[model samples]
Target: MPRARPPPPPPRRMEAPPLPGFSEEQFRAACRELDQPAPAAGGPWQLLVESMGVRIYRLYDEQSGLYEYKIFGGLADCPPKLCADVYMDLDFRKQWDQYVKELHEKIYDGEKVIYWEVKYPFPLSNRDYVYIRECREMDVDGRKIWVVLAQSVSVPQCPEKPGIVRVKNYKQSLAIESDGKTGSKVYMYYFDNPGGMIPSWLVNWAAKSGVPTFLKDMQKACCNYSKNT
Candidate 1:
């Protein structure tokens, strides 16, 4: 009989502290900024900030996309012990800063990241008002996940409606990987509409309507296709 394969090796743990290079003050500052509220009033369009403003502090490992530390939310309000493991590691901060810089640069060209649709369910009749927004991909966990950082602006409501409304939306997607020779996996996380903004009405309508159906259909299409091996 063939010898049994050796047991898979145990998972190795990192010994570093969180965000080594950055000081507690720095982390606190970043968190504070993230928690700050957006401007109340704005120009022609009402502006509200999106939740994508997370100050992610992660520690990368040998594993393709493993994360050692992930701190989300403002420092003051965030769980004090969230990333206690490596919250003080020096090398981690160096890498974190580099990643943040790259992320900022990616935001400028977000139109190329993820595609968005102006109208929900289906495009408009003339399709003239349709807009496609792109999502920026960031390395999260051990792989590239689409991340969108958006700021909101107040906009006029319906001509009949009296007051403006505040809405929050996010849009991001990830292309699951398949064997390089075979191509990619079909599963995708369509985060939000263009610019990552969704009106409250859209959210309610989507849950009641058939957006979930669209998502499932997309997934099936990807899963059913066979590579041209």
Candidate 2:
């Protein structure tokens, strides 16, 4: 008798059905927020921490009862284009960002969508997000800038998993440009409501510690990107 055929490889995960299209108008509106100036001190924006040349601020959202964060800084020794590329590289992100449990992009109806699951500490359920994102290059007064925008989106195809909390309210914007040297000038705004009973103190602590840590990790990743890719 012929030797038993080798077992078939595991089937690939099925791609979700077509998602709703994110419009150019929506994308442009989001980009405008990234272009706006940072909120001045002594306003609703309260400064959280300033370290390593990065300033982080938080503003309370009355409607959501959550905090939104803004960051202004530069990534030293990392060029603008390289910095942006490293940020948008999802495959590489999985390798560097320890919090990223799962991240990938899928195209549906000619639009690309991102799915991400983040690992939370023990006893806390993981949080997952499905969002639409776009990136653009712009020239303002002869200065080149890169802008990336993302917001949560709902679709029937990506239903919430049982053990994970679905984050329905989330938005992120980033603008990067040359720092007049070999570094990148960066501005970032982020907000997300991880749907659960998580305490406010824990959330605030995570943001305060997490943002700086993430930027440092990204900077290190950027330094190694060319070799890795």
TM for every model, in the order presented, reads 0.23, 0.85
lDDT of all predictions:
0.27, 0.83
Task: Write model 1 residue lDDT over 155-191, tens digit each, in one string.
Answer: 2221212222212333222222222233322222222
| Model 1's TM-score against the true structure | 0.23
Residue-pair clash count for candidate 2: 0
User: Which candidate ranks first by TM-score, i.e. highest?
Assistant: 2
lDDT of 2: 0.83
lDDT of 2 by residue, 204-224 (tens): 778777788889999999999
At residue 160, what lDDT does model 1 achieve? 16
Which residues of candidate 1, in runs, are more than 4 Å off?
1-128, 141-143, 147-206, 225-229
Q: How accurate is candidate 1 locally (lDDT)?
A: 0.27
Report the C-alpha displacement of residue 196, candidate 1, in angstroms. Answer: 22
Spell out the clash pairs found in candidate 2.
Answer: none
